[model samples]
Target: MKDKKSAKLNLQHKQHQNGHLSPSTFAKLLDLEASWDKDQLGDVLHWIRQIVALICGLLWGAVPLVGGIWLVAFLLISSGIVYGYYAIILKVDEEEFGGHGSLLQEGLFASVTLFLLAWTLVYSLAHF
Candidate 1:
């Protein structure tokens, strides 16, 4: 009986280790993060979004286009990626992320920055 009990307990422990995150640990981590400054979170998200935008811009720029038409696609795709990640994956509230205005601004800023960088690279490569 003692061996059976110990074996059952060991099995339970192993199951816990192999299974999904414990609710208590997940809740505790969320509680710890909740104490963080909202602005800091927004800033971090903003920068990450910008980097995504830049990457999208570079990829879009790689395709040949006669005009600035690629920019529209870049803006849409980059913003979608950032918004999806934050709103769906992270479950971040708009209030914590500095509202829609900030989000749009960040997306625009990133798109423009990336556009400029891509343009410069392409121009240099073409001329040289």
Candidate 2:
């Protein structure tokens, strides 16, 4: 009985691993993960856009500012930096759909970038 149960479980696991869950299995057709079938600018932009937006949100929310205006400008510039860093490091020629950089590689870039930004703000304010 145990052998039979194990066999059934193995078969189910193999099926799941095979990528056999036809893309159209869901009638509603919710295509969440960006399609990797095509290598294009749209996909690369999408990848960088997501991470940059996240960081922008974090900076905007985390900072307790007295400013009435510069907030929007700061987020915009940060987003630009994040996007630029990725484009430079990844090499614009490579299609981001099938990216090779590790989380540490990308995360390090982001961390260093945000750190510099924070340091700059701190120094600028310290003088003011």
Evaluated with lDDT, which candidate comes out highest? Answer: 1
lDDT of 1 at 3: 100
At residue 26, candidate 2 shows an lDDT of 31
| Model 2 weakest 10-residue run by lDDT | 27-36
Q: In model 1, what is the error at residue 123, expressed in angstroms?
A: 4.9
Superposition TM-score, candidate 1 onto the true structure = 0.56
Per-residue CA lDDT of model 2 for 1-128, tens digit only, reads 99999999999976774433333333212333423232233333444544554565455445633352544565455446544544453334334333433321333344445644654565465546
For residue 57, model 1's alpha carbon misses the true position, in angstroms, by 3.3
lDDT of each: 0.59, 0.45
